[model samples]
Structure formats: structure tokens, C-alpha cells
Target: MSAYAEITYEVEDRIATVTLNRPEARNGYTIRMADELGDAMDRADRDEDVRVVILTGNGKDFSVGADLTQGGFDFDPETGPDAAWQEPAGRCSKRIFTMNKPVIAALRGAAVGGGVTITLSCDYRLASTDSRFGFVFVRRGIYPEGASAWFLPRLVGMGTALDWMISGRVFGAEEAKTAGLVHSVHEPEEVLGKARELAREIAATTSPVSVAVTRQLLYRMASAESPFPVHELDSRLIGGLGSSPDAVEGVVSFLQKRPPEFSMRVDTDQPAYLPWLNK
Candidate 1:
């Protein structure tokens, strides 16, 4: 709800679009941009009507990464009102990582370093055919930020992550898709449109509460050391189905061959017993 100077947040028809508005600078990343992005994402997440989020930039490039022209030192965290200090990109990535709703990234032109890393947590990435990607930290005599080391390998495997990070080479969209780093590729002008189509599909066919719970379960439990905890949690989730109106609607609608009219809301209907939500 607060005003944003560096980015734009707009919601319509159950989807929220958060855009990097600095097209003139190729949407260069900055400390202010990072804060604005984190706030916009949090705003969308808190809005019960927003079932999905589309993240993209204006103009040709998604971002040229951090704006080193004005001393890249500005992106690092020395201290803040929050109890802990986190790198700017990490702050955005972490917020996206924990969201109940799905976040999709639409990339075009150049998306290197922090630009690409900041989007690593998005559920889907739709890249423009002309998109260029890189993890060019080593070549620039710096380390990668945005907790990319943890996110990159999980998306593209250890071997590929190492190859890209160690070599610090830029690659095109097809290679990114082939390696599972991106979900799909589209024409330069169609990237954001494709993202919106995908968002609308999710918004139309899914229960908000169900999507929220499932998204959190996958991210929160994917790295677990064992399956015992997951199964235990799964049992708990399934047992709650008896009390879930959406669950019954899902089955009844299928039997009747009709579009489901689910009545669950993410903010109010999520299971109160979830460990993360409870904690």
C-alpha cells in the first residue's frame, strides 16, 4: 500500500504485476530498487485477492544487474531497522521464497548477476528469446549475492551451477531453458504476455488456500534430510481434508464435470496447524 519510487506494483483480476521501472538505466539494480521490490512483493502477498504475481522489467533489458556506476557499495547491508542484516538481493529473494502465492519472472534482454539471481526463487521463469543470462561475479572480481549458490544448484544441478559460476560466462535463453534454469522461452515482445497467461491459468483453476499450502510445503520441505517428517506433515494435511470445503468441492465438481467454485481464502482458510505458520 505504501508508495514505491523505484518499481511499480499493480493488481488486476487476481494477479499482481510488480515491475522494475528503471528502463532507462536498463533497470539497473540498486539498494532502493531492492527495498521497493521487497515491499511490493509483501504487499501483493498480503492482499487476499492476489492469487499470483508476475515479475518483469520495463523496456528492453530486465536489468544490467547492480548499478556499479554509483558505487556498488550501496547494495550491501551495514545495518537496518530489522534485527538482522541481509544483502539487498537476498532480501527480495528470501521474501519471494516464503510467499504463499506463486511468483513468475518474465525476463528479456540482459539479465546478469543480481538481476538473474534475485529471480531464482520465482516459481516459473519465462525468458525472451533474446535474453542473456550470467553469473558473472568471479569475472568481476566479486562473489555472487542473492543466496544464488543455494538456489542455482537446486534448479540446474550441481554440475551446471558450478560450470556457470566458475566460468562466469553469459549464455542465451535456449541454453537456460535446456538446463531447467528457465521454464519457457518466448519472443522478445511476448515474454510478459506469456507470463500473464500462465498466471491467469493458475488463478482460474486452483483453490487459493490449496495453492498456498502446496507451494509452501514444496519449498519448505524439499530440502529435508529425511522423508519421515514430510510424511507426518502430509498425513496431517490429508486429515484436515474432512474439514476443508474446497477439498469436497474439488471432488464434487469433478464428478459433476463442472468448473470448481472453491470457497477457501489463503489468509483465513489455511490450516492453523502448519508448523511454519504456527511457529
Candidate 2:
């Protein structure tokens, strides 16, 4: 496992846990941390030992978004002269969109600004009872970075997304779930446990090859309009994965009424672009 000032990683029972470690600062993302996280996700996706990835924060708050007081990067449009604000935006965008493995965010604290965007990127999201979520970009005199401008509206609908982002108001875990941001809420202590449990369930039942293909397809469909090209991509992916060793193992295991022993290795040589670049 690599060391990161803002995050930590561990693997157990085929589940890879990626924790936001900077609790004192509310797990805020620094530029370097963002890059490290992206690299970590890439590693997790490529490693056959890892079947699922859980994302969580160490302290009371999940993440408060970008570290503003730390200096170097300024999001304040009034104070900043030009488009320097887009630097952090671009970095975060890359991190959220490029993760290949299924990510489940275990939320125990406030998820604000870029934090909300991160949570939205995950395949599944679980929040603790004490958790709170919001987008504070408007209050900070900036727009939501890290795909919030696009993801939020799509996840919660245009009207709700606009209201939440523009108001910059804080919402509790229950409200977040109701608004379709979080899938479920659990006790503070059970937050990560529930996330892990869910991950294990997925790992136990889902076909590794199919899961990866589905994740890619869903991501591509989120922003793309041309169904023809998307279908072509899907066909190609399925065609290749259908003949994989894992695919055969999955079917054989089902026939034998036993758990599949998935080979974690997967091919990812497909073309990078096919719409939904913002996600």
C-alpha cells in the first residue's frame, strides 16, 4: 500500500478499502491527494486480488471538499483574477471519472462541495445517521467543481440540483437519501461495516467480467446520446469478455452450485472516449 497524506488503503476479503485519512481537516482534498487517489483507484482496478472498493473518511466528517485555507489554490472568483480556479476542478474531474472499479462511499460526516461530487461518482453510497451533505460552492463564490455541475442535476433532477447548489444549504443524511444522493443510512459505527457488507455481497454474487462491463457501459451512457456507437462499444466489450476464463468459471460455478473463483485480471484496452467525458 502506498502512503498518502490524505488517504489510506487496505484490502481484506477481496474488498479494497480506500479511506480519506485527513480527519482533522475534514478529509479535505489537496491537489496531491487527488492525484494519489486517482492512482490508487487505477491500481485497485488492475489488481486481481481486489473485487470491490469502499471509500470512507476517518473522522467525524467524510470530506469538506477542497482545502481552501491551506493556500496555493484559490476558488474565490472575486479575489482571483482569471481562470486559475479551474486547476482543482480539472484534477478532481479526472479522479472521479477515471476510477474503473466499483466504488462505494461510506459516509459518516458532512459531504460538501467537491465531497458531494466524489460521493456521486461512486457506484453505491451509504451514509451514517450523523452525516450531512451539501454543496457549498455558491456560498464560496464559486461553482461546483468535480462534475457537480453535471452529475448533481442528473442524479437529483434539474430543479432539485439547481436549488441545492444555488442555495448552498446543508442537508442531513435522511434528506440526502430522500433526494437520491445516498442509497441508505446507517449508524455511525456501522457505516463502514454496512458498506463492506454490501461490497462483499456484490463480490460473492456478481460476475467480475460482467460487473466491469456494466460499470463502463453505465458510465458511457450517462453522457452520451448516440445509442448506435454505445451499442457497438457494448457489443465489443461483451464479445471479448464472454470468452474470458472468468466468464467460463462464472457459468461453471453456477452449474455446480458453488461460488465462482474469479481471476481478478481483466483487459482494459478499449478506446477511451465515447461521450460522458464529464462523468
Candidate 3:
């Protein structure tokens, strides 16, 4: 019943797995795939049963970047870059940035250009020993897209982002992990399994509403100008959750030596001041 054309979405337990299905083409990023990815992200965010999402490819490569086989001169002659052509990777990245559930990118092979930028928006990335990454936009006679200019610097620092982007060179998974681009690296066939295990761990241990609010707060406050605003937000959240049912259950369960079964649902129980209006 899934409407996706280039991706496969399957939900098991509390984890939603979104797989890029274009293996023959190395899971290249295309307009249709971008739209579908955004849709899949929305689905995961809206589904209360889905606590986490894992993004991976159906083939050897996570993604080889954009598909160029559409031939040259495909852009509108009159509008050019200003044409209504929104960058596909940007669409997917934007959705991931705002998702309620955490996303983990599982990379096995090549992740170039759009490939690298799209994953940059995810909360965590796990790669295989055989994985490779490239920021080859400059080499392709273009600059980085998918808001990578902002994401890359925030992730690996300005100097590292500039060096890799300027050089447009391919790098291995170990280098990426050392640069703070990825959380962990495992054997090729174990990459997706490891990602799933992590997702399950989070889903099992965390409260959905708390996780959603905390994720937004962390990402939003990361670029804030001052700590005062974050303190205010923290106070507001704590005041709201302090006496809630989940809070009581969490404390009681700990005292009794048992797992806490939080009763609040994110959809209806989220604090009124959530999302930080100014952010």
C-alpha cells in the first residue's frame, strides 16, 4: 500500500526502515526519490508507533549522488538556476532536520555529493568498513547543495568542511568517523543490523514525547545566541513534565526496579510551548 516509487518503507516494532531501492543505479538521488523520501519522513513522524527511522540503500552503495543521465541542458532555458527547480537533496534534508523521530543513516558504499549532504541532516550516521564518502560538487562544476554549506561546517568544523568541499575528494569511512561525520563503522554486512539495534534501543528506552521535545530543543539551541533562552525553555519544559503521569511512573518504576511505561503520547501530550516559537 506504500505510494513510494524509489524507496521501500517497512515498519517493524517501533522502527521504520526507509530503503532507497535503486540498486542498479547505485541508489542515485533523483527528483522522484527526493519527493518520496520527504513523504516517508512525514509518515514516520506522524506515526505514533514509529519511534525511530533508519535510512539505507538496497544495494552496495548508499547513494552515488544525483543521476546525471537526464542529459545536459535539462534546465529551463529561460529560468536557469532560478527556475522553480528545487534541489531534490534539499527537500529530503529539510524534512530530516525537522523530524520528530531520530534518523540513522546506514552507509555501506559510496555516498557522494548529494549523498553526503542528505545524510548530514540525520541525527546519527553508521557506516560500514567499506563505505566511502565524497563532496564532489566542485568537481562536477557546481557547488554544494542540500544546505550542506551550513550542515557540514556545523558537523565537522569549518576547516574540515572547507578542505573536503574545496578538494571534492573521496574519503573512506574511517576518515569520516575520525572527522566526526559518522558515529560508528562496522563490517559491510553488519552496518544495517547495527543501525537497527541502535534504533531499537532508543525506541525501547526513551519516552516519545520527551525524545521529540529534547531533539528539537537540542538542534534549535545549538545555534542560539545565548543560554538564557535555553534556560527559559528548559524551565518551561520541566515545569510542564514535572508533575505529569510519565514523570510519576518514571520515578516509581525506578524505586521498584522496573521499566517505566510512560503513558503520554507525543501527538496530544506535547507541551504547549514546544518547538520554540522564535526558532
Candidate 4:
């Protein structure tokens, strides 16, 4: 929002594209890049006109990990939340995690260390056939950032997560798909195009408020230990649909064989009764 130097944010046709802008260094990870990315995601989430977000890097490789040439990460344990301190990658990934809008990550070439970790919270990941991914923290003598340890296990299972994190080795697109890390694989030239196509489809058909609710439910409720709480929440949501204009529009449009015109906005129409909002 405040003149981003490390990333670019653009919104068109209801899709916000946030691209990593450091092409000269293969979009290397940096503190400034992390802050810019977090700001971009927050901007997209709050904009009613933006229904979907597509995240991709500018050049051939998504990112070659950190820019060691500029000297690696330096952190101070004494830095507090009020101070100018936040873990680099989590600032971006955590912002994406809280977003009501769906996010799709488009990857090509290498996505290693901080690169792949930052995208772990995205709802979907579409990578090029030549794309390679890694959690190379151990090899680099630094531990993982971005809360990837939590996200990675949920995505690829404990076994695969352990294998990748402990070994610190890179894997290709096919293996990423097989492990459920990436949703789909595409040609390098077609990956971003495919992401845009998917974003358009989501923006055109789905109810914004419904997608927002569903996104939160999947990320929060699905991980709960008890199904009773989910059932209670689901019943409440279903009951509220009777009073929802968008719900009526959905059914009427279907009967008329036309595109649904949902009037509910994600920013204002999301139900305030949600129990997880405070936490």
C-alpha cells in the first residue's frame, strides 16, 4: 500500500496479482520483500473488488531462496512485537492465512528455503513442470521460518514432511504433486495463465461471502479435534441462509439458467457470529 519496492500489486477483473519484483536476483528473499508481500496480501483481502489473489514471481525462477550476497538473515531475540521486529517469512505467510479471499501460488523453476515456506499457507499451488521445491533450512545452517513446520506437515503428511525437512533436499514438480504439496503442474510458460484462468472462474461463479466463510471453516474447523463444534457451526450457517439475499439469488439464478449475481460483500457481509474471529 505504501510504495512497495520489493513487490508489485495489481488488481484487474476481480483478481489481484501480487508478483515478486526482484528479477535481477531471481526474486531473492529479503526483509523488505517479506513486509511488502504482507502488505499486498492485506490490501487484497480488504478490497471488495478483489475476489481472488494470484501470487507469483517476476522471472524464470520463483526465488533462489535468500540473497546471501547481501548477507544472510540477522535477527535479535530481544526484539518485541512493539519494536520493528517480526520473523521475515511468517509476516507474509500468516497474512495469507488470515485472508478471506482465496490465494493461488504460481511457481516456476526453483522455490527453496524461504521461497517455498512463504507460500505454504496459500489455498492452492500451481507449479511448472520444471519447478523445483525444497525446505533447505538444515543444509543452510538455519532453521525454517514462515511457520512452515506447521503448514508443511498438514499439506504433505508427517512422513513426507519429515523426509523433506530433515534431509533438506530439493524435489521436482511431479514429486511435489504426488506428495500433495502442489495442486497441479503446468508448462513454465502456461503456469501464470492457468492461475489467472482459475482465479477468473472462482470470481465469476462463487458467492464472495460464502467463499470467505468456507475458506475460514476449512482452515480452522477442519483441524478441530471434535466434529460436534463443526456441526454446530454448520447448522448455524445453514439457518442463516434462510435470511440471506445471496442465498435466494443463488437459487433463483439457477432456476432461470443464468449467472448468479450475489450481492453480499466479503468485507462487510461475513457473519460476525464466527467463534474463531476473536482468536
Candidate 4 Cα misplacement greater than 4 A, ranges: 71-84
Q: Tens-digit lDDT track for model 1 on 76-133?
A: 3465245455778898998899898999999999999999999999999999989999
State in Å the error of residue 73, model 1: 3.8
TM-score of candidate 3 relative to the true fold: 0.94
**What is the TM-score (0 to 1) of candidate 1?**
0.95
Alpha-carbon shift of residue 8 in model 4 (angstroms): 0.9
Worst 10 residues of 3 by lDDT: 68-77
Q: List, residue by residue over 1-279, the lDDT tens digit for candidate 4.
A: 579998999999999999998999999999778878988888998899999999999999998877866644556436635556667888888889989999999999999988999899999999999999999999978898899989999999999999999999999999999999999999999999999999999999999999989988988886888999999999999989988999999999999999999999877787899976746
Ranking by lDDT: 1, 4, 3, 2
- Where does candidate 2 clash, by residue pair? none
lDDT of each: 0.92, 0.76, 0.88, 0.91
Per candidate, the number of residue pairs that clash is: 0, 0, 0, 0
**Ten-residue region with minimum lDDT total, candidate 2:** 269-278
Cα RMSD to native, each candidate? Answer: 2.2, 3.6, 2.1, 2.0
lDDT over C-alpha atoms for residue 178 of model 2: 90
Give lDDT tens digits, candidate 2, residues 90-199.
Answer: 56545655655688989987888777676677888899999888888789887777777777776778888988988999989888889888899999999989998999
Over the full model, what C-alpha lDDT does candidate 1 score relative to the true structure? 0.92
Model 4 alpha-carbon miss at residue 44, Å: 0.8
Highest lDDT against the true fold, candidate: 1
Q: Candidate 2: which stretches are off by over 4 Å?
A: 74-86, 234-242, 268-279
